[model samples]
Target: MKAAWLITIAPFAACEPVPTAERFIPDYRGVETMLLADDLVQFNVSMTNALSARDVENYAECAAAGYTLIRGWGFARHLRTNVDEEAGVWTADAVYTISPALPRGISTIDAEVVSAACAEKGIPTV
Candidate 1:
């Protein structure tokens, strides 16, 4: 009986460990930026190994923040973000309004602050 128990436990010990953050590290594919209007912009981002929709949305937000800075803007307000995943690849279609002054919304983002956070998080920007 002891031998049987040891044999079962041995196989369990050999099993692979649980997934870690390194295992799920995302592969940022690319970002496409489009100017919808004077201050409105659209960001399309794609990636793989995304753990959740929030990852793709963050990518889009990062792109938007970078674009805002590039356009000499200091802020961006999130309009919308749509996330999709297929065949293990995640994509996000996001829209934002860039402005020199803070936009009148709760989703406003400071371009410099968000860009720095994105860099620290290893997320790519436009």
Candidate 2:
């Protein structure tokens, strides 16, 4: 019975030990600038009339996935136009601002992926 218990515990004993303060040091230099901000950031998002809810969901998802430092309230506008007249037609738009930083070691492919994901959600790239 003792032998069986030892055998069962042997594998668990081989697990690595948890790290301590001495072994793990926090790095603050990389985040110092972001910790201090004086101005608000903004962005503009515009979409076609056919925009769907999925697009908005995707935009929010992308924003969450990215490295956003700050965000601000957004404004939107809707316009109407006549088919025959191009000059008099008013335009519709939406504006929102978010300050995001590129994570260290982020590749171009990562950016493209994020952009595409946002586009899929209906968030236009600025």
Candidate 3:
């Protein structure tokens, strides 16, 4: 019985002390304020393709000219193509985020130009 008791208590003896709440709490109010401001003035956009680095730069340039944000994703093709190609039917999708205040007409042109540029770079788009 004494040996059993020692075995149980030995584990607790080596436990580390818990930190106080003050040590873990962060100044989140500033972050929250920034997020709120961003919500008011940011736009969201995306593109789907399989373009190489040079192609991506071209797309980025188009996006910048139109005042938007952009990113890319990978998908499968009938045959292996770019670095991101997989075995099955997959595609790469690029995304962009921009401010909401920009003119709506330019946004459409932005999407067209970026999509075309990606295609020219060997990145397919639907």
Number of backbone-clashing residue pairs for each candidate, in the order shown: 0, 5, 20
Q: Pick the candidate with the highest lDDT.
A: 1
lDDT of 2 by residue, 15-108 (tens): 9697566433211111111212322222222222313433333333343224232232222111111112123221222222223333333221
RMSD of each: 3.7, 21.3, 18.6
Model 1 lDDT tens row, 85-104: 99999999999999999989
Q: Each candidate: what lDDT?
A: 0.95, 0.33, 0.33
lDDT of 3: 0.33
**Model 1 TM-score (2 dp):** 0.83
Task: In model 3, state the lDDT of residue 13.
Answer: 82
Off by over 4 Å in 1: 1-23
Tally clashes: model 2.
5
lDDT of 1 at 48: 93
Off by over 4 Å in 2: 1-40, 57-110, 116-124
* Deviation of model 3 at 93, angstroms: 8.8
TM-score of 3: 0.20
Give the poorly placed runs of model 3, Cα more than 4 Å off: 1-109
